[model samples]
Target: MRRYGPAVLLLLTGAAVLRISLFGDLYLRYVQAGLRPYLIVSGCALVLLAVVSAIISRRPYDDGCQGHRHGPGVAWLLTLPALALLFFPPPALGSYSAEREAAARAAQGVGTFPALPKAKVLDLTLAEFGSRAIYDSGRSLKGRTVRLTGFVTRDDDGTWYVTRLLISCCAADASTSKVEIRGVEAPPTDTWVAVTGTWHPEGRLGTDEAWPAVLDAGDVRTVPEPANPYEKR
Candidate 1:
């Protein structure tokens, strides 16, 4: 059993990966959608390696008669996470993660963004609205009723924002984008919602003061969390 620890770990981990990536959108909770293929390949490889390792270990190897080695007794404990991956995959990052992120905009300087579409109400990601609100010299979000969807997060003062994580590749590298929502009762933290509102400018564009954009919410409706929780930057 001790000799099989690594093989067991690999097998459990690979099956977990395949369960998340090959069968469904569960991988979206942790990585960008474009990365699904890579994850699938990696899972398949791990499973194959585990099978090969187990087969090779079963082959007879001659050793001059002696007592058995310890065979890394403690190493078996490492399989706990692999087992967890199989049964209890972690939830996507939520209000706790959002609350810890600082309220600073990226260093993108103020500039004119291209005009928005002809639609009456624009559907925008938190990242898009936050960026436009903070740095767009044109005030692109001005006068446009927009809808944003994200889980709720709050500050110590009870100010709640529609918050979402933006990832470059995976959850480990995710950053937060949020918009302070006003004129509506605060929802419980981490409750997903669609917020329809107009931008409420807070400060001068491109300045630190204008960060973490504000929205004057006209309507707030609880919604199911989306399939892909993180926005890929």
Candidate 2:
């Protein structure tokens, strides 16, 4: 048991990474899709290491560990996180996280953005809506109907906003963007919803330095959380 202990630990760690990255949405909570290939390769490498260690352990006299008789007792600590990840994957960033981070906005006087895509109802992420509303000199959103999906958040003054987090690399670097919703009661906090609305230029324009842009919603409906929760840059 002692000789094979390190192998068992590596096996558990590798399995946990692969399980979250391939078999479930847990990996989406930590990293973007581009990192999936590296994760899979790392997991495969760890599993291969476990197999090699186990094979060497069975040999009576092996030079792999310089014939050390002691097991990797402290190394068992590495398996704790793997066990936790397997049993209790963390939830995606939502209202609570949105509340904690400063609202992300496009820099005032930034470069021009292309005209809004033509559609009866254009679908947009909250970050895109914010950038166009706050930085686009052309006021591209002046007369367009757009749809946004995000978890619900409420302001201190009782206004509700549809919010999503933007992640450049991982959850640690995430920042939030939101659009205030008018004409509908705020949904329960953290409830994912698709809001179809037209932009209302009542708030600070040409910048979100003062407040988030407002959306005069025509329809609001609850929806399941998307498979990929964070907006990637």
Instruction: Return the top candidate by lDDT.
Output: 1
What value does the lDDT take at residue 95 in candidate 1?
85
lDDT value for candidate 1?
A: 0.89
lDDT of 2 at 133: 78
With a 3 Å backbone cut-off (N, CA, C), the pairs that clash in candidate 1 are none
lDDT of each: 0.89, 0.84
Q: For each candidate, how many residue pairs have backbone atoms clashing (under 3 Å)?
A: 0, 0
Quote each prediction's TM-score. 0.94, 0.86
Segments of candidate 2 deviating more than 4 angstroms: 59-77, 103-106, 208-210
What lDDT does candidate 1 reach at residue 82? 85
Lowest lDDT 10-mer window, candidate 2? Answer: 202-211
Per-residue CA lDDT of candidate 1, range 1-233, in tens?
A: 66677789899999999999999889999999999999999999999999998997676555731223245577888889988888898999998887777766556888999999989889999989988998888988889999999999888898899999999989999888889999999899999999999999998888878887999999999999989999877
lDDT of 2 by residue, 1-233 (tens): 67787798889888888988878767888899889888889988988999999998898855676546665578667778878877787788888888987655455665578877689999998988977877676788888999999999998899999998889988898888888999988889999999999998755555556358889999999999988999986
Q: What is the lDDT of candidate 2?
A: 0.84
